[model samples]
Target: MPKRDWITRLSTKFRQCQQSPFWHGAVALLLFYLPQTAGADLIAEGRAIVAEHCTRCHVVPEINPKGGIESTPSFKGMKHLADWRRRFEVFFTLPPHPALVTVVGISEERDKSRPAFVQEIKLSVDDLDRILAYVDTVKN
Candidate 1:
């Protein structure tokens, strides 16, 4: 039950399991590596994430040139990737969900005017990076 012995036993068990059932081995490998998928380039993943989350509020022209029901910030015209990277870097860093307060410092009135979806939208560090990568590719 030493740590090294435990690992050796675990490895032996894993090899035995793999020999008995290839499908189970494959599934175990998949589960082990699944979280690694988050590291993919932002442009591809970001666009998809934004399309699903942002289109409801903002006029995400990449997804829809015509725009959505509510009028929020125009991601099309704005320097979204750089702007958003900075915004999110600050938003996620502070404790206790200080995003609203942070937004107030930049553009208080404008923040108040944001669409409902925009207000509720939250992104993890990886997701934010991906979103910025996608937005950076988009030109006005």
Candidate 2:
């Protein structure tokens, strides 16, 4: 609540860390190493998500070997495009995607009767970021 209380809590934590030293290492590991894992975890999550959902119509060579409809471009090829980043960023709003993809909190739910579409993927903003982060690694 107050500045004094905050300092007191911090000092208490410092004392606790001093007493165990394990806390010091734990904090260091989290501060230094966890950040690297964050990007890796995001990419892993994106890979899994794409494998589960995107592989339906899109070819994601980073995660899948052989799949995707011929009409759709492979992520590998698309990565070299000038607007690839922008394309993935707002992909949920584009063309056939609108019928099959839904970005949580971003895109509205579509009617089930979207004609030829059978399934729609629901993705969060975080998922989109994850996908972008993974896509960023593509060789283009």
Candidate 3:
């Protein structure tokens, strides 16, 4: 069949299904379940991103050995803080972060307690979103 005819047939079938009670229930179930699946996938992606970037300095769930420095808080621990979500939202723009990336280089007045060997790390907004989603799953 021609492409146009194939699409028209499919559309007609879909419209027919839309009028059926069975299809309505199926649609409702799909609508209810899809977001949960998407959320799970997003959390999984976030975990992977944390493992790739933050694991060097922060312990992340399910990544083994409880990595990161002793002084630096684990991802699970940080999640327990009331303001952690807000802090994480702006984490990349925070002080010492820009310096860590050599955006301006560390100033003498900067916090002296930070690890000297901490490397510059950069993440896309999507990556940050995923990491936050994963962090949300971490229990206190």
Candidate 4:
């Protein structure tokens, strides 16, 4: 469909729906429950992905406190930092993390001078989004 036509049709339907009792109830139920379910699912999947890839290096507090280097910061600890959101948003572009984590499409070339003793992690842009979403919910 043409972009303008599609948008017009959508707006027209939305306007029609706005006047319906069923619409209000449905929208209310969705507004009340959807975020809880969707956000929880995103966080849960992010946690699983982090457990599979990130726990190898970063701490996840109770989930994997002793899993990685003792000096490494936990997810909650990182979450508390002032630039935590920006840092996590572009973590794959940062030093050390880039060496360990590879974003499927954006990662650059790496040194192969020495044989890798540990496996390199692979993540998609979607996975990165999930990680940040999960990290956002982490508490001190």
TM-scores, each model vs. reference? 0.45, 0.73, 0.69, 0.73
| Candidate that would win on TM-score | 4
When 1 and 4 are scored with lDDT, the better candidate is 4
Stretches of candidate 1 exceeding 4 Å from the true structure = 1-40, 80-85, 88-122
Which has the higher lDDT value, candidate number 2 or candidate number 3?
2
What TM-score would candidate 4 get against the native?
0.73
TM-score, ranked from best to worst? 4, 2, 3, 1
lDDT of each: 0.62, 0.83, 0.73, 0.82
Off by over 4 Å in 4: 1-23, 109-117
> What is the per-residue lDDT of model 3 for residues 1-140, given as tens digits with 9 covering 90 to 100?
46798899999999998899998899999999999999999999988877777777677666845567787777778778899899877666676455553212322333667643466565566777897898888776
- Residues forming the 10-long window of minimal summed lDDT in candidate 3: 101-110
lDDT of 1: 0.62
Q: Model 2 segments beyond 4 Å from truth? A: 1-30, 112-116
3 against 4, candidate with superior TM-score: 4
Instruction: Give the per-residue lDDT of model 1 (tens digit) for 3-102.
Output: 7988999999988877787877788899887755544444678889778866665677768778765545667656644566575455434443343322
Tens digits of lDDT, candidate 2, 2-91: 679889999998888788978778889899988889989998888888889888888887667588998889999898899999999988
lDDT of 1 at 68: 67
